[model samples]
Target chain A: NAGVTQTPKFRVLKTGQSMTLLCAQDMNHEYMYWYRQDPGMGLRLIHYSVGEGTTAKGEVPDGYNVSRLKKQNFLLGLESAAPSQTSVYFCATRQGGAKNIQYFGAGTRLSVL
Target chain B: QQQVKQSPQSLIVQKGGIPIINCAYENTAFDYFPWYQQFPGKGPALLIAIRPDVSEKKEGRFTISFNKSAKQFSLHIMDSQPGDSATYFCAAENSGGGADGLTFGKGTHLIIQP
Candidate 1:
């Protein structure tokens, strides 16, 4: 079982460029989240989806947008990338129930110059 | 504002030593606290967790000590080895708040020397 998988393991973008990061989960989890990890900043939530077709803003949702078009996939998009947006991004999923354990994907390293 | 604060941004210890990472939170509504371990180029994985009602919980060589009154929690790794060197993060969540998600600490970089 491939718990959580993120695509585009590494990317480099020029300022104002746009890109999308993909997160897929085979565990059939109902909750998915997008987070960015910066040096000495830990992981900050960018956006999240409680279930398919439902999304919400997280701690650092300003420069990103997310969509849960399907139960197995969550997409994070940056309309216009910036230098400050250069960070390692992670995708995580949790089962829908009382348990709070969140499974994470390897990660996507994005650098905006 | 940062809800969860972690101390000792970096640490080094000799093999077989004990390494403790501490975290404190300001949110009283947080009922769950968990520690995550991340290796280089990997996502953070849950190491251990504790609830506010419990003072301590242990799993293998990893332990979580929680103090409800002080809103503080810590992770203690016994018999630390070189393989145990990695970044550790502390996170808190309020189950009462629907889908709010977890607030994570800045993380602690630990190096266990051989």
Candidate 2:
């Protein structure tokens, strides 16, 4: 299985631009998460999905909207990109609960002008 | 917004030396703790993990030392090698099957020189 994979390995965007970052997992995991990692800062959760069709806000969710139309896909969208959003974004998924281990995707680097 | 706190933002070690990274959490509900290792231009991979029920867990050259009462945990790399050089992160998740989603530490940059 591919485990977890994120699309658009890298992107450059201007202010007020809208784009979507896609995350997919083949593990059939019930939990999926999106996080952004900035230099000197650890990954911060942006949005998460507990299951297909259910989404929750995380520590850093502003300016981002998420949709989990299918269990295998979780999408992160930026309505109006900002410079502050320039960072490395990673997507992860876990089987379920604390006992289940989490798997990660390579990551996508985004630049918001 | 961080729930888990980690220290020693960076470290340098010689080959065969032992490197330790520490982390602590404020949420008492956290029961599951795990460590992730990341390399340049790569995703963070699961290195090792432990639960509050146990004080320590080891796998090969990597070990996880946990203290439930202390609300702290640490990752130790024995006989450090340059190949082990990377970024290490400590995380904690609460006791239930639901909140197990990790709250990660800031991360530590480890460098092992040959």
Model 1 interface CAPRI class: medium
Candidate 2 chain B weakest ten by summed lDDT? B93-102
For model 1 chain B, where is the 10-residue window of minimal lDDT?
Answer: B93-102
| Chain B TM-score (each prediction, in order) | 0.98, 0.93
lDDT of 2: 0.89
Fnat of each prediction, in sequence: 0.76, 0.56
Name the regions of candidate 2 deviating beyond 4 angstroms.
B97-100
Model 2, span B14-102: residue lDDT tens: 99999999998988887778899999988888899897878899999999988877888999999899999999999887657453278
Prediction-by-prediction clash tally: 0, 0
lDDT of 1 by residue, A17-109 (tens): 999999999999999999999999999999999999999999889989999999999999999999999999999999876779999999999
Question: How many clashes would you count in candidate 1?
Answer: 0
